[model samples]
Structures are given as C-alpha cells and as structure tokens.
Target: MSEGSTGASVVPATVHLPDDRYIPVRTEDLVAALAREHDAFGELAPRLAHVGEALTRIVSAESGAFSRRIERAYAPFNPDRETVTVGDVGGDRAELAAILAYTFDKANYDLLEDTQVRAAIDSANVHGMKVRVDREKVEELQIFVRGRTQETRLVRTIRRPIVGEMREVELYRRLAVVFRMQNSVEVNIKLFRDIPVADLEALLPHAEAGMSNLDRIKILGGGIGAIGGATWKAAALLVSGTVIAGQYFWALIAGLVGLSVRSVLGYRRAKHLRSSQRTHHLYYQNIANNAGVLDLLVTSIGHEELKETLLAYALLLARGERIDGADALSRAVEAWIARRFHVTLDFDVADALESLDRLGLWADRATMRPLEPEPACARLEQHWRERTTEDYHARTLSQRG
Candidate 1:
C-alpha cells in the first residue's frame, strides 16, 4: 500500500477525514465500557502473585535492571491486595497463578515518569505480559485496544491532523477518560466524530502507557473524575439512592444516581471476578488436556529432548505460564525437516511459526487451539464458569438507550 507523503518525513503523518461524517465521542458510552473493564477485574482480579511469579520465572534471567525495578519499585504496588480466591482458577494449581494486568499507554515529559512507564514495560517484557501490538488503524486510523485474547492489539491513532505523538497520547488519555462514563450505545456511535480542535491541545501533551494496577491506581483516580458530572448525578439516583415520591423530583434524581453508582460498582466487581474465573477455567483445562495428550502420545515426540519440551509445554499450559515458546518449538521442527526433507531449512522462527500457526500450533497471542469442551461423562464443574454477566449488562445497556 502506498503511503501519503509529508515532505521530508515520508511517514504519512496525517490522513484525511471528511468533516460531516465524523462522530463526536459521547463520553458516557466510552465511560461505560471503561467502567466495564474495571468492573471485570474486581475483587477476584488476577492476583499480583500470579504475574509476579511469572516475571520472576520468565524475565529474571533476561534483565538485571528490570528484576531490580520490580523488587524495589513495582512489587510495592501489587494490585490484587493478596486475595487468593477460593476457586477462581478451578482445580488446577497452575491456573491459580495466571497473571492478569491492566495496561495504560502514556507519553512522559518528565524523565522520571518516563522511567516509571519504561520500567513497567521492562517488567512486562521480563515477567511476560501477553504479546501486544501498538498499531495505527489500517482503515479510519481510529484507536482501539483489542484484547481479552492472547494477542492484544492496542491502536494509538492520534486523531489530530496536527500535533506530535505526545499530544496524541493526551487525546488518547481523554479518549480513555471519556470512556469511564456510563454505558450507552449512542456514546459509542459518537466515536465517528472528528476529534474536536479545542480538546486536542489539552489532552495530548504528556501521554504514554501505564499499568492500571491497584498500586498505581492513583494515576487513574485523578483522571476518572473527568467523569461527566450531570450524568453521574442521574445514575446515582436510579441505582441505590432514594428518589422523591413527589414534588420537583430532585430527590428522585438524587436517589437514582446514588443507587446506580453503587449497583454499578457492585455489579462490575462481580462481573470481573466471573470473567477471571472463566479465564482461569479455560487456562486450567488446557493444562489438563495437554497433560492428558502428552500422557497418551509421550512416544510421538520422537526424541527425548523434544519429549521433554512437550512435557514442559504441558506443564506451562497447566501452570498458565504463557511464555512464548513458538520460536523455540520451531527451531526443533526445522532440525526435524532438515533431517527428513534433506532441504536445508534456514533458521526462520517467523516462517516456522507461520506454518505451525496454520496447523494450529503458533498462537498470535490468541490460542490457535480450538476450545474443546470435555466429554459429558468426564465433565467437571471446576473446568467452567459463567460469563453471562456481560450479556446481562449488554442487554441492560441496549434497553436503556
């Protein structure tokens, strides 16, 4: 695809957008989705131990600076608050340790702040966060973070015809800010609007990526208050607070907003825990299934070393230790092909993974494996959890608008 040129720097710094077709972001709707994200991680949110252990295991061997940073700086801010949910990870001990993180991208003007975010990335790289991409849109050039999967794609389109990357980051942060309001469909439709010229300068000055961790939560607390004022009042009245039975109905509004906020927070916490439980269940089952598969096909691995690798894969799967092993599994395959095909297979991890990905082995962060349900006779409740809460919320939002 040919890119639009901008004088000396050929990076197509700007993309044309039609004036009339743009959608103004309805702060409420985006807020609702953002709220949903927070609610999804509630009480039983993935424990700090899970991610910490993974980092200690995966990243410790790679970077001394990162290891020191985690111990000295990050560990103090663990978000899970030490809650080891009774059965969040099903029957498997490994899934119990699955690391869950809340990520926020930022651009830092201050060297110290930049260091902090870099430290988080360093930490993630070492400990093993999921494989993620920060790409601009191939289409409208709008931004989005596509996750809830193995491969997370975080798009950071600046949306401004003018302004540098840092400015775009603030806009992105506001985009995240406007996102923290009440759930509404009309709000999502507003994303099509052109980024307002007024809000552009204020939002994009010092933006970067960050972790929405409980420890670092203060970072978001300051911004979440960017929450729309009038709407929050209305919601509080409807959810839990007392509404007037008569008169100006001012009391009614108050009651509803107060009630709604409480109900919303409560519902969100429950929803988050439920989702984590589902994640744990799925990760747990994969471990069990892999182990079972290895048990039956132990000899099929062909060589003892490969057999050991398969066993390690099974263990990591069982443990929910998502260290990317596709690159290595690939090298082994190349050695195998060279022996068989007599064609010298170059050391190309990408191609090996591509071939494996086609055969359902290499995962682009999303598991290529089909989610096979257990046979009815061997089914276990510990192997599953309900995610119906999101459906219910979706329905409520649909009806409300």
Candidate 2:
C-alpha cells in the first residue's frame, strides 16, 4: 500500500494500485480512497469497485467514523444522495456559519434535517439579531446575505475598471471591506477618509448598488456592443469567412477553426473598453452626488460574512506571526482586536485553535510554548527573514555610499 499525502505514520489499510505498489490509507481516508478508485475505473473495469466502496462504508461505520443515525439526519438536506461527510458537519462556529449560510442561500432551508435547521436558526439568531427572519420566509433572510456577497464581488471587480491614480483608492475600498468584516467601523471610515473627496463621491453610488460586479459588467458590455455594433458585424464576417465563395471552401474551414478564438478576443476587447469608460465616468462624477456613501457601504456588509472573513485572515496572520499555543494565541488575538478595532470579541478560541490543527497550519503539540515551528513551514520563514535582513543592510549601505 502507498502512503497518503498527509504523511501521517499510521497505516489503517493497504490499497493495491494498478501498479504493483500498495498504498497504505488511514482509516479516515478509507472512504476517500474508495471514491477515487470508483472514479478512476470505467464501468467495464470490474464490480470490485462497488464491493470495495461498500466494504469501506462498513468499516467506516464499525470504526464509528459517523453514526448511521446521523447519516439519516442528513438525508433530507441531501436529497441528491450526496453524503454530508462527518468532517463537514463538525467544524468551528465560523465554518459552521459558512456552511449553514451557503445551504440557506441556495434555498435548501426547508429541506434541511432537524439538526442542521436548528444550527442554522441558532447561528442566524446569534450573529444577526437585528435582522428578523421568518421560518417560512428563509429566502427573505437569504436576500439580505446575498446582497453582501454581491457587494463584495463588486468591490473586487472594481480592479478591472480602475487603474492609475485611482489604484490606491481601489485598495482603500478593498481594505475598508476587509476591515468592515472585522467589525472595524472606525478603520472603514479612516480608509474612506484617506481617498480624495471627489473620488469618494464618484465611488459611492456604484458601490451601494444592489447589482453584483458581474451583472454590472454585463450591462456595460452590452452597452459597448450596442455602440460598436458595426465593428462587431465586420469582425464576424472576417471570423466566419461567409464572404468567401464556395470554391474556397478550405478558407471557410480555416475560418471555422479560428471562429471561437476571434469571438473570445472580440469579447475581451469589448469588456476592457466598457470597463475603462465606466470607471472614467465614475471618476468624473460630482462630489455632491453621494451624500451617504460611507453609511451605505457599512450597512450593506453582513455580520456573518465579516466574522468568517476576519477569522480566516486572523488564522493566516497567526501562522505568520508564529504565535504560541492555543491559549497564548487567543489572548494575543483578543488584545489585538481590542487595540485595533476597539471592540469586545467573544468567541470559542479552543475550537478556532482546533480548526487550525485540522487545517495543518498548527503543528501537533510535543512540549509547551507552541513547540518549534514544523520544519516544512520553519524553513520558509527562516529564508524570508534572512532575505529581509540582507535587503535592509544593502539599502543602508547604498544610502551611506
């Protein structure tokens, strides 16, 4: 059996590959391995694949990987026969919130089993108390969250439309969005405050719009096509080789081969032009036009999105800082939040820390003080620090010379 990618020493089962090599798969990886095998083999390969999957399921059940009773609980929500694996259902609050949000947003609220539905209700109530959601009108709740997702997409899309002097402005807007997710209202204000007064005014309405980035971009693209309709028609003739006579059928065939390529290029050019014009128009808008842009941007972002985004960033930052054990890291983060955002943060640090371990960001404990960084990550960190120090020395020497 070949060892799994996780590189854990434990070998629960051996899988004989098409090659002579046998892969040693851990108990937790049994179901996954069976799935990979099922996908790799064609229908004519053998019924052995099915038997193997069934055996793996039996082993998983016997080893208490997941209870049959819990699988039954997930059945209603997963009518497509998709298994909502044990690891998926079991996660930290932020992860659970993301899963529940996605499930509800996709209009699957009523289909959720009792456990999942309860979890969703509890999370929405806790994170979004001010927003009222009727059990019957789960879609209404989804609409609110959906708007935030759209706005974020819009914020990211601004990069394509904007360039040059407004690049910093766009960065500020993005940082505002990120900081806002961390519930840092003051930081958002500070970010917006730094932007030019005219630019801020121009950005306000576009940012506040309920339309997503893709939707707005499509609208602009359509407008561009209308204006440049003649150009497109001429290009289509060139691309289609419809102008060529029957005697030159080979030319027509060549045109057909390049048809898709031409269409793609035409679409790209039209999109770029549309984005440029739209951003230019926005750049020239009057400052008086958007009086409440700041408030609009702030209110549009949802609580759950902010928390999830912040948690992800916080975990990444913790890894970079090489923060010590769960307890120490939690205190450091809580203090950082208090200092930076000036807000009281109440969360389950242990669960968050456990999630880091599950993600392979945190190394398993050997002794106290977070142990030494795992060699895999430690080498990279050391290289970066050394490079930074060398750069600093070179810069000082250059200035002195």
Candidate 3:
C-alpha cells in the first residue's frame, strides 16, 4: 500500500513453460462461441452476425494470393511440357513454387544456371501456361491463413496495456516492465489471470488488426527476393550484353548481397515468433464472460448510453490500481472512453460512477481511492515465479545435456 515502487521489478530465479502450456485455438470452437453471442447482440446483433458469416466465408475460400501467384507466375514453367499444368495440378504447389523461384533467381544471379530450369521458364513464358492447385492443399493453406488472421484480429481488438497519467520516465519504466512480461510469463494463464480485469473488460472492437509483424516479415523476405530478382533482370535487359561485364556484374552482386541480408534478417526475426492463438482464444472467451457481467452492471445501475463507459471504468478499478481520486478518475476515464470509442459511443461519467459504486469497485465512499489487486490475483503473480517457462526449459536442457 506504499506510494513507492513495487520492489524494482524482481527477476525470478527460473522460468518454466508448462508441458501443456499452449493449446491450439480451434477455428470451429471460435465460430461456435461467436454464434452463441448472436441473440445477445441487440441493435448491433445483425452486424455482428454478418461479420461472423464473413469470417466463415473467408476461412472456407479455396484459393489465396499465394495460390493465385503459383497459378499465374510459375505454373507455365513446368519442365515436363507433357500437359499444361495450370496452378498446383500435380499436388506439388509448394515445391513447384519454390523451384520456379529458384529458376528466376538463377536467371538473375547467372550462377550455376540449370539449362533445364531455363528451358522450362522460357517455354512457360512463351506458351503462356498457368498452374492448378490441389483442393486439399488449398484447404490447408486457407485454414492456416484463417487461424493467423483471427489471432491477429483478437490482439488488435484487445491485449493493450493501459497506462495512468504518470510522469514520462515512470511511464517508460512501466512499459519496459510490460515488454519484459510479454517475453516471459505473459504466455502463462496464471499471469493472464493476474492482468487487471478492467483492461480485459473493454471487450473486442470489431475491426481485425491485420497480419502480425512476424508474418509481415515473412512476406517481406519473399517479396524482396521476388522484386529484387525481377529488378535485376529488367535492368540487365535494358543494357547491352556487350557492356554487361562491369555495370551488370556489380549491380547483380550488390543486389544479391542486399537480398541475402534481408532474407537472413527475416528468417532470424521469425525464430523469436510464438503463436498467440491459444492466448487469443483464452482472451476471447474472457471477453464474452465479461460482457455478461458488464450487461448485468448496466442493467442494475448504469444508463443505456453509459454502459460501455461504466464497464471500462469498472475494469480499470477492478484491475488493482487507482489512476486518480474517485471524481477525477471517473471524469478522466469517461473522457478517454469517449475519445477512444468516439465513433461508436457517447460518454457519460455520472451513471458510470454510480455503477462502479454499486459494483463495489469504488475504494471508499469519500475519497474513492483505487483498490489493490485481490488476494487471488497477488497469489497468481507469486505462482508465476515458481512456474516459469524459463525454469522448465533449463531443467529439461540440463537433463538432456
């Protein structure tokens, strides 16, 4: 209860990832859960239903950009020339795409140029052939895309760390702590349970957050290779072959080196990536449950317009920290919510405070102080130190070593 810091952010002696720590978030389960919330939609119910339906369609869609690329760009480069293999017709979409890419790379690099690869590409380019993808492969790719996209959407809508109006240095310190936690026990459920309920209570915004940074890196690597190769070929073609020795050689070498560095960076960036599907699923379910609680709080003590604002404040209060005294905190939270969700909502502080008081989130009658984490939440944080993934991996490695 002291005003001082929480003991310089102690680093645990060990970290451990639970053996069954991550469970895959099944897309079907998410759909089922979303479907259950349909009747609870009220005025926005129809719109929500439409989004869910769109999700279904997207996940079920057969071909993707990669699939189309395989069909359009490389399918004609098939070596056999026995039949016109449009897209992934031979059930080797992935391999064929890779080979086609390698062929293009060889053309640009002019290194170990395979005669057969050149012949195939030249044939395809002239013949104007397209590729066909296997139905099963297309389905697999779709599912992967859907899973990645949904997790991205969930994080975009939620998973934000809310900050109080502390000093700039203090704010950076808090953010540093958040970054560290994100790397360590943030993956664990105990730590998740320890997160302030208020942050979790805002529910998800409708928009999808787009592909994650890691996924974007993967795309970047491929894009660089493809674009760089094409650029080199185009530039070389513009110059005469008689003068190709000086300018062409230097350009090709420099471009290849640049492409190699980017590819390595993208690959290295990918190594630190951890899938958040399980965490997103857990948070998704939490949002649904919290929605019911917020609804009850609204019905009991809040106005129709004040429902979301009250919910946000209640979450902040229950989250185990006070931003300001009751009156000031209430006003600040209302203003922030109005601005944060301005397009979708209007703000109301009076009813929101009343709701918070009714819900026991208000610290005391007069001062309206912030409440500390519940005993259960404190216990969860304590438990995380003893059950960290770092400890688990260390022990396993020691045994194996």
Local distance difference test, per candidate?
0.26, 0.30, 0.30
lDDT of 2 by residue, 1-401 (tens): 01211111111122111110111123223323323433333331233233333323322222231123223333333323354455443324333224333322221111223442233323221000111223331211111111100011111122233321111111111211111222211111111222221122223211211223444456556545554654455456676766453335555455554654655665566556545544554444322111132223222212222232224324334353455555665565455445544544433354444323422332444321222223424432443344422232123223544
Candidate 1, backbone clash total: 45
> lDDT (0-100) at residue 264 of candidate 2?
60
Give candidates' CA RMSD values in order.
Answer: 25.8, 26.9, 27.2
**TM-scores for candidates 1 onward, in order:** 0.20, 0.20, 0.18
For residue 383, model 3's alpha carbon misses the true position, in angstroms, by 44
| lDDT for each residue of candidate 3 in 287-365, tens digit (9 for 90 to 100) | 2121222222222221231232223333353332454444555444444434433422223345445434433433454
Would you give me the overall lDDT of model 2? 0.30
**lDDT tens per residue, model 1, 71-156:** 22222222222544443322321211111010111010011133322332222210011212232211111121111101122222
Comparison by TM-score, 2 against 3, better one: 2
Estimate the TM-score for candidate 2.
0.20
